[model samples]
Target: MATLLHIDSSVFPAAGSASRAVAETFRKAWEEQHPEGTVIYRDLATDPVPHLTADAHTAGFADPSAHTPEQAAVFAERLKLIEELEAADAVLIGAPMYNFTIPSTLKAWLDNVILVGRTAGDSPSVKGTPVTVVASRGGSYAPGTPREGYEYVQNYLSAVLGDMLGLEADFIVPELTMAPQVPAMAELVPLFESSRERAHQDATVKAKTLAERLAA
Candidate 1:
């Protein structure tokens, strides 16, 4: 059966999180297409993985047999995360922008799973796997917008997830998410609604399409 590695790093619940809400939509569509498929779900906000440590970092380059007890223990945890990524056929991430970048939880997860020789180098184990990231943000950062240069979420992920890991990365962005709540941005609420709706539609279509492609 197919497998999806679904990760959500939103601190808020689905009702309050644009990324979580859209990610759930995509997951539902994916599950509908593959009734027997497996979804390895990780709620990073609730169960955040450990941040990378020196022991874990050095162990990746050292031989397993030579690892100290501390390195061994930390590296074992890292391997579990890397193996999970290797086992997945597809990946979905809810990367809501937090202070102009992905949540620290999501970054920690990446730090754990990314190993030099196995998951990040030329022959990455999960190379070419499709990853869909729901990159939600509070303000508009589309090209030509005043804050376009501040759009580090997508740009950073593209480099890390695509250039480094070699995954086929795609993004479904829902911007201006704060317009409805921020009085200063109240005029952009309509744009937020439109973006949110389009994000849902994109998630649904992409989920179904990818599912069908995998089945074929």
Candidate 2:
């Protein structure tokens, strides 16, 4: 069976966030289809990992075998994160847009995964396999419209992951642009539920196809 990793990185727990709901829905359906498939989850909100430190950078510059204790520890941690990503047949990344971009916690996680020669080699245009990104915004940010001009999450995300890790990024954008004005229980709640439900179904099929590729 293929391995699937689900990661959520929303710092806000008080306000209901669309990205968290969507990620959970996708994870549930994926697990149901692939009952025996290994699943791993990392919630950056509950327990955050440290950002890339000076030690991490120094370690990244050192040779694997000729590293100091601190360097080895940081290197080992980075390796562990990448190994989890490499072993996976599919990946689900959750993020609630913060100031028109991805969360810092999620960015740190990406930093952990985008190791040279591990996720991607020295190539300039390597194609990363598909990764589902569940992104939520308080405003609409889909491309080709005026709203999209202010948005940098999807483009920046696709560029970094696709360019460095070769991941073809897919997106599930359940926008809550009109939420603040709507009635919570009657309007926003139901919208989030149905939107996430729809995204979950789509991601289920995607997960199956990804698994098939891994099994091949």
Candidate 3:
């Protein structure tokens, strides 16, 4: 059976988080299409991945057999995270914008998965892995918007996961997620609702289509 790696990094609970909601919609569609498929769910907010550090970095580059006790320990964690990615047929990530970028936990996960000689480098290991990102932004950042170029979540992920690691990534972005809650964004409430609804609709379509494609 196929396996899907579902990752959620929203600090807010599922009910209040737009990214997580979008991801849930996709999950439902995915489950409907693949009843027997396996899902590996990771909620980074409650169980955050440790941020990369000097030791982790050192261990990632060093030969596994030559690693010191501490380095070996760190490398073991990296191996577990990479194994999850390598084993999955598809990936879905809930990435809400936090201060114009992705959550630290998600970034930490990325750091661990970008295995130098294995997943990266000249003759990379993993390639064409399909990834869907539920990107929820608090404010608008589409083309022509004042903050048009300020969005980094999609760009960063695409660069690292797609361009660098050769993963095939697509996104369903829900903009102005803070419109209903933030007083200053009250004027954009309608836009927020529309964007959110559109995201869910798109998620359904994408999820079903992806399932068909993967099954074939």
Alpha-carbon RMSD of each model: 0.5, 3.5, 1.0
Error of 2 at 115 (Å): 1.3
Candidate 2 ranges with C-alpha deviation above 4 Å: 13-15, 123-128, 177-201, 208-216
**lDDT of predicted model 3:** 0.91
Using TM-score, rank the candidates from best to worst.
1, 3, 2
Residue 1's lDDT within candidate 2 is 81
User: How many clashes does each candidate structure show, in the order listed?
Assistant: 0, 2, 0
C-alpha TM-score for every candidate: 0.99, 0.83, 0.97
Give lDDT tens digits, candidate 3, residues 175-198. Answer: 999899899899999999999999
Q: Write the per-residue lDDT of candidate 1 for residues 1-216, one digit (tens) a residue.
A: 899999999999999999999999999999999999999999999999999999999999999999999999999999999988999999999999999999999999999988888999989888999999999999988999999999999999999999889999999999999999999999899999999999999999999999999999
The digit string of per-residue lDDT tens for model 2 on 54-147 reads 8786776678788888888887888778777877667888878899898888988887767665566675222455678987777556667568
Q: Write down the TM-score for model 2.
A: 0.83
Candidate 3, run of 10 with poorest lDDT: 117-126
Which candidate, 2 or 3, would have the higher lDDT against the true structure?
Answer: 3
Q: Considering lDDT, which of the candidate structures 1 and 2 is the better prediction for this target?
A: 1
